[model samples]
Target: MGSSEFQSPRVIKAAGLPYFTPANNGGAALNPEDPSTPTLFRPLTIRDVTLKNRIMVAPMCTYSTNPDPSSPAIGALNDFHIAHLGHLASKGVGLVIIEATAVQPNGRISPNDSGLWQEGTDSEQFKGLQRVVNFIHSQGAKAGIQLGHAGRKASAVAPWLSWEGKKGSIRADESVGGWPSNVVGPAGGEEQKWAPGNVKYWAPRELSTSEVEEIVQAFARSAKLAVQAGVDVIEIHGAHGYLVHQFLSPVTNHRTDKYGGSFKNRIRIVQEITATIRAVIPDGTPLFLRISATEWLEGNPVAEKTGSWTMDSSTELAKLLPEFGVDFLDVSSGGNHRDQKVEPHGNYQIDLAGQLRKVIQQAGQKTLVGAVGLITEAEAAGQIVQGADEAVATEELLAGQEPKADAVLLARQFLREPEWVLTAARKLNVPISLPVQFARGLL
Candidate 1:
């Protein structure tokens, strides 16, 4: 295969033509008049990693592991993960990030979440993940993993199981190999059930200061394990009401210790985790941090009184992340507070990403931003990923406007269409790499 515009020499290269070909390659590069290519199909480089396109598959927990605690195979990857992630990579996605994996057993959102903390590279967790990462690399797509601790939301039943009959935050108690007694967070009590009534979530125990430090180490440890598994990137899952976000939001972190109170205190855990992970991973490896950006608690009477994690807070933190060695900020929102009022609609979080992107650009920071949420359809994605000059040259629109994000991430959309990149290339009238075996199908 010829050199890929998106491929970095540092990471492993797959044989055959690049899976997600760039329009700038020889065929299109020869035509100076051919400028119809969309930015969504363009490559994005962060540190040593370069993606073939701006479409990233957002981390979505599959909860496909064995639920039985007594089973040694619990919290390990298997055939399902390979088929799940491999199918996406083969279809031309530039980056395929694995789901929210736990840093420790107790940190899993469900009893079936994949986990790190195994002894060595020879461990089942390491071998399983390596197999999955190898497949992603073989398909010419960069692979990433989100290391997270579910915190107060731990030990819940999978969404599908809950939808069948149970509702709310249903727990997977001891009867099902889950440790309900171990459910913990920044502040502990019955009042902090996430959902107040009829929810199966147990009252969480507040993590002691020492326990908090240990969790930070767990993130770093998990990152080290990921590096060994040949993952191209490591993302700290600080978003959605997880452990790190639990500390970031004042609504949940009522701790009187050094970890709570002021903004600096509240952000301590995330800062520490970032520093530690950077210390462990190779310098060339990019570290991406996913953030809620906002808890969506604006204008609520309860939020007004108790204070909430708002856009202002996110902006303040975004500026400091680059200094902590974060190369990219994956902007997402909500899932922190129950009273958080959000009217989900088209481009609901795009504006927030745009606001945050402007702030980052104004500050002259190097951190790249990614927008994720209801971003379906190829044309809309192309516009969001650095607006097309020809498509938006009119004065009626924000003429010469910068894009809302450097890239657009999708969860449900990718789940619906694994070949989204190929479909997008076709829609935009651009050429992309197709699997050699599947070339006949396209013809």
Candidate 2:
């Protein structure tokens, strides 16, 4: 590609809205009426892919299905999934990451969680996912998928119903606000732990080094599959006390061997896994890792009260990850334990993101980082980036808040209202082009 063939800038000299800044070119002048400063809405390119805005949709869970809700959702192209994703794309998010889809049947957080566990290379569910990917692309938004394993967190009622899961508390069934009937965990044939995975949360035959190697291969294969399905980015789930999170903390991963007992060993699998995934995926495609920066687990026996996987450890991970070609760190906290100390409030994770950013910068690494968790106002989310762009969402930003997350990755919010972005633009008075199908009501 020659310089002459390059496309013109997407925005004019007029002020860019939001606060996140563009990497190149002076941002457009400010406009009080628009508040569309040249900052927050800037384009960002990770690796070889480019994003239209810093905001990205966080990987959210949407346990929707046709026929019945109790069954294992064979990823179908139902109207529900379309309307949900279509609205976000039309709203003009630069990138939208699909929710965490289980890599294997046993790895699912619940039966209804979307997955590619089947053997079909081009089956209906796979095709449906592709259609969603195509729709996102048609709307000029890059589609990404999060690869995950629920581990002990496997099996639970969808968030929509009144299901509360914490450590040591496992509801016997979905009868009394328990997890849905099908939601099961690692410990079966008994009452599953509601809070975290019930039972000892013990090492299941613990992934042998060979099995660990197989898991790594699975991640790489999944990344390849996501690309084949037209996903623009691939994210590994290392947060929320899922499979990767279990390895990060001493509590969940209690093996006396090389795979555990030390921070380096615990992080070893992820390090190798990322490298493996990157090697398989086309170079330049964006690759991200979502991490439980700090276990925040008070007495996590393994990592102890003071151990790695701390905010500082997260920074180190980011810096180290760049070698394996990680484009960004989705810095989210907790999940290493059922009772992680959550200092809940809007934008609470900002401090950790900020600190991690500094640590990465000091390490002389150039990889960018994104923050999630409780970002309410769009401006505040941008502020944490110092207006540098790149922010993700958890559950809160989807329900309330100003379109704050750079890419608001939603779970239930997306499921409840995929076209929530439509509401967001209208409520905020920001301009956007919603799909014609959804236009009737909005207009």
Candidate 3:
């Protein structure tokens, strides 16, 4: 279908339910005196795609895909992905970023993780992904897909199946339906053990220089395919101890080559991939890079000596991301190491996002920062977007002053409430477009 076809009245009606005005439409001006005009409902424009609201569905792995034991073409989207993502799209979300999709076969987090490397528009998998993007566009929500390689974290059984034998322990499944033993990372010959249950963990072989280059190309190729699949945004999964994060973090990257050791070297891989993908995708297509703002291993007495990834390094990286053409930074925390400490507080990683945002702004770059982690309440979500009290708290924690991120990404909360965006709109009393079928129900 042509690009103009997506704008047809029928498509628009099917995609965006009636009773909802396009948030970008020059509608009536919101009254300042109206408490319903919450900041969360304000539109956000990154490049050519403008989000109808500040709320974005963060990429959360579902491990639901078609896995072929004989084919590398496994990891194609099945009915689960379409129904799962399609449902979220119809809920009036501003943006919906699909979960971590592997760029290559071995890059998958499990045997069932979605992949786009081998799928094209002609393939069934590509069609499924395109169907998802169509559904999202129909709902007037910007669609995004996160491209990632799990690195050393790959080749593990799905989390649900992992609990069959051990609690919180991810064991390798050598069964016919399991992943192949081809996990690779920055460090080779050094075996890292898993905690939680003290399970023996075999280390991944270090990626050779040639292999590294191929991986970068793989990311570019996957991004190109994603764009062809109708994705409006491309998020590089550089966070949560993924392949790119492995290269960024000092704890995992101990290579003597140009891809490791110093800060510049550690970030080289991600920078290259970002640049490559930026070149491959169409101009104005927003590019987002998710980063583990802090590994959360620093400062702790048990972790202080490990010389782990820290906010300082992340700040430095955030400053250079714009140079590589990154439009947004999705700031997240931890997942680089098993022993990392996490405080069970709401908006736990907002401080890190605030810090990264400050650094990016101070560098005089246009790159937007997105805060995520435990942000569940509507009032708090509004405050973060408004850069008000809630934003002040995150800023104060980071630099004792300054504003917060430009946007916020919500994960588990969206899983808990697929209609959270609609719910938030109602709670904030903001005028939001809803499905015509549910319009009376809201009344």
Q: Point out where model 3 deviates above 4 Å.
A: 1-12, 15-36, 71-73, 193-201, 299-306, 387-402
* Tens-digit lDDT track of model 2 for 1-443: 76445334542221222232212211111231233533344567787897765667888777664223343335444567666775677656667888887776546665456776544556655776777777676666778888887765655445554344443323223342223333322223332232434432322334556666777787887777778878899999999878887777666666566667777887887888888888888987888889887877555554464353577667657778877678888878886555566777766776677677767766877767777776545445455433353244423334433222233333445445555445544554445544433446767
Per-candidate TM-scores read: 0.90, 0.74, 0.87
Q: What is the lDDT for 188 in model 2?
A: 31
Badly placed stretches (over 4 Å) of model 2 are 1-36, 65-78, 159-205, 298-308, 389-443
> lDDT tens string, model 1, 1-443?
66555465333344432343321211111122344456667667788998877788999999898777767677889989999998888777888899999998999999889888676888778888888888777777889999999999999887788888857558888877788889999999987778775567777899999999999999999999999889999999999998899999988899999999999999999899999999999999999999998998888876787788989999999999888999888999999878788898778898888888889989988688888999888888877875523343333235656788888889999888877777877787777756544556763
Residue 294's lDDT within candidate 1 is: 90
Which pairs in model 1 have colliding backbones?
none
Candidate 1: stretches off by over 4 Å: 1-35, 387-398
Name the lDDT value of residue 144 in candidate 1.
97
lDDT for each residue of candidate 3 in 1-443, tens digit (9 for 90 to 100): 77565464323435333333332211111452244465567667788888767778899898887666566447777668768876777776778899999998888888778888774578755776787787677666788999999888887767877677665546456663544357788986544423333243446788898899999999999999889988999999998888898888878888888898888898999889988998989988999999888888866654555477888888888878778899989988889787788885876788778777777777778788888988898878766667422323343335644446777788898789887877877677776656544556655
Better lDDT candidate (1, 2) = 1
Sort order, lDDT high to low = 1, 3, 2
* Cα lDDT, all candidates: 0.82, 0.61, 0.76
Worst 10-residue lDDT window for candidate 3 reads 20-29
Which 10 consecutive residues of model 2 have the lowest summed lDDT?
21-30
- Compare candidates 2 and 3 on lDDT and give the better one: 3
